[model samples]
Target: MQLQKKTRSGSFNILGISIKLSIVILIFFGVVFLLNKVDFPSPKKTIEKIIPNENFKIVK
Candidate 1:
């Protein structure tokens, strides 16, 4: 008796795409968070400079 080969299908593609998208989203958010945290003049300071109204003060 001969063994039959298993065929691959679209499920693999869907899983691969989902995982890749998740990783890209995670990395993007991580970079954004890091940028907000690392002050070369920080996110808060930049926002304050851009909109220097008393109402727009950093709420933190």
Candidate 2:
């Protein structure tokens, strides 16, 4: 029946949404974990290393 089809489709939509949400959450946590494990230089340190000159600059 038409009602049965509608209910099944609604459940499928919910399942799809939940799966996508879980995947996004997992990716976010994985990124956070990897960043925590790695040691990166501070923004100031990186800025200090750059030599500002005409070659790297966009305008003359």
Candidate 3:
């Protein structure tokens, strides 16, 4: 006669979530690192916005 021991599948659920979270955090940090090393061109034109005074309401 042979016997088999069944493992609990629920016990490793948290471990899986933690591993996924760490991988996401690692990828985010890697992207930030690469972005820091890059130099992007600045805008050639100046942005101008005209805000009408009527849009502002004075509150008592």
lDDT of 2 at 37: 98
Q: Which of 2 and 3 is the better model by TM-score?
A: 3
Model 2 misplaced stretches (Cα beyond 4 Å): 1-12, 41-60
How does candidate 2 fare on TM-score?
0.47
Instruction: Provide the overall lDDT of each model, using Cα atoms, as 2-decimal numbers.
Output: 0.81, 0.79, 0.92
Worst ten in a row by lDDT for model 3: 4-13
**List of clashing residue pairs for candidate 3:** none
Question: All candidates' TM-scores?
Answer: 0.47, 0.47, 0.49
lDDT per residue (tens digit) for residues 17-57 in model 3? 99999999999999999999999999999999999999999
Quote the positional error of residue 8 for candidate 2 in Å.
11
Compared with the true structure, what per-residue lDDT tens digits does model 1 show for residues 1-60?
A: 999987975456778789999999999999999998886943555433465477666767
Rank order (by TM-score, best first): 3, 2, 1
- Candidate 1, TM-score vs. the true structure? 0.47
Candidate 3 global CA lDDT score = 0.92
lDDT winner between candidates 1 and 2? 1
